[model samples]
Target: MRVDAFDFELPQELIALRPAVPRDAARMLHVKGGVIEDRMVLELPDLLDEHDVLVFNDTRVIPAQLEGRRGEAKVGVTLHKREGLRQWWAFVRNAKRVRDGDTVEFGGGVEATALRRGDDGAVLFEFLGDEPVELLLERAGTMPLPPYIASKRGTDERDREDYQTMFAKEDGAVAAPTASLHFTDRLVEAIDAKGIGRETLTLHVGAGTFLPVKADDTADHKMHSEWGRIDAATAERLNAAREKGGRLIAVGTTALRLIESAADEDGVIQPFEGDTDIFITPGYRFRAVGGLMTNFHLPKSTLFMLVSALMGLDTMKAAYAHAIAERYRFYSYGDSSLLIP
Candidate 1:
């Protein structure tokens, strides 16, 4: 399919610079059976049954955005994937000034030597110290905000808390699973009280999520791999829930992708621990996930393509049109959508 088929005009002002104050106060658009309904995030628990299970991504966002100097030239890099305890693959802002083996010195005693550049244009860098890279990032890095928001306003202390979800625990992701950001303690309690089952898996969202689809056709686009894990116990529980006639609703695209990667042709999920470059496009058959709850995505993005695949392209286009007309916020800090096909 042509990539332009997924393109839509979005007004600049529709992009959300900040998340809703109470988080749960954010609006949600419910799309089911070709119908669109306006809803609120707080009303999520009422929309599903006690037998339904909500799958969440527990990957914590690390402070991966770093600014440094390679000799006289200024360099900025966002660590996207962990290659080792001290090695990371990062997208460099000043690639022209960096060369393999060149050391970039970030402030607060943090520095790394560029090992090589990948075909996707990400540079591999090995941190030059014995201390953990997480500690080094704590002293030097800031939250890696999506470029749509960061380009409008600078990242601040508020973003440190706002950008992360309440379920954040395992540290590795450079980007937060935005769909989970709308969840709060109150909301979770409500969901639990309603008997909606909840489970979590880890998928370290990389900066590749922010990359645009420059390809003219969907087949020409390549998705960068992100590391994810689903233990045997969790897989068993998820399977059990489904066997009991419970619908498995994935909380975000990251969770949806990981679970789908773990599912067999029969739709039974298995234990998985590896990198997944699962590019979901139209005509793809969804194996395990029954539904998805995710934030609105960018035009011509892979996320949009995934959502289009979930709910037909025409249906999503109409839903998005309604969202835009209704003035719902957009992007990582935007409104939510519950897609049920």
Candidate 2:
């Protein structure tokens, strides 16, 4: 399909620079059976039943945005993937100034030498000291905000807590699973009281999520791989819930992708631990997840394509039109949508 088919006009002011206070205060648009409804994120518990299970991505967003200097030339780095305990593949700004084997010095004395360059134009850097890369990042890095928001304003201390969900635990992701950012402790308690089961899996969201689809056609686009894991026990539990006629509600596209990658043709989820480059587009069959709760995506983005697949393309376009006219926010810090095909 032509990528241009997914394009839509969005007013610049609709993009959210900051998240709604209390997290759950964000707006939610419910799309089910070709019908759209306006609602609030706090009302999610009312939309779900006791037999439904919500799967969340527990991968924590790391402080992956870094600033450094390569012989007086300023360099910006956003770590995308972990190659080893001390080695990472990062997309560098002003990359031409730093060659393979060049050392870049970051804040707090943290330094790394570029081991090589990846085919995708990313630099492979190996941290130079015994201190774990995680520690070095904590000392010298800032939260990796989505380029849409970061481009409008500078990142600050508020984003540190706002970008992270209450379920964050495993540390690896460079980007936050934006859908999960709307969750709060109060919302969790409410959902639990309503007898809805919640489970978590890890998918270290990479900076590739922010990359645009420059391809003219969907077939020409290649999705960047991200590491994810689902254990046997969790898989078994999810299968059991489904056996009892429970619907699997994925909390974000990341969770939806990982769960779909772990499921078989029969829709039975299996234990998985590897990288997934699953590119969901229209005409794709969804086997594991039945419903998705996610943020409104950008025009011509892979995420929009996924949502279009879940619902009909025309239906999503109408839904998005309503969202825009209603003055709902957009992007990572934007409003939420509950999609049920």
**Number of the top candidate by lDDT?**
1
**What TM-score against the true fold does each predicted structure earn?**
0.99, 0.99
Residue 334, candidate 2: Cα error in Å is: 0.9
lDDT for model 2: 0.95
- Residue lDDT tens for model 1, 1-341: 99999999999999999999899999999999799999999999999989999999999999999999999999999999999988999999979999999999999999999999999889999999889999999999999999999999999999999999999999999999999999999999999999999999999999999999999999999898999999999999999999999999999999999999999999999999999999999999999999999999999999999999999999999999999999999999999999999
* lDDT of all predictions: 0.96, 0.95
C-alpha displacement of 182 in model 2, angstroms? Answer: 0.7
Q: Candidate 1 has what TM-score?
A: 0.99
Off by over 4 Å in 1: none
lDDT of 2 by residue, 141-240 (tens): 9999999899899999998999998899999999999999999899999999999999999999999998999999999999999999999999999999
Question: Model 2, stretches more than 4 Å misplaced?
Answer: none
TM-score of 2: 0.99
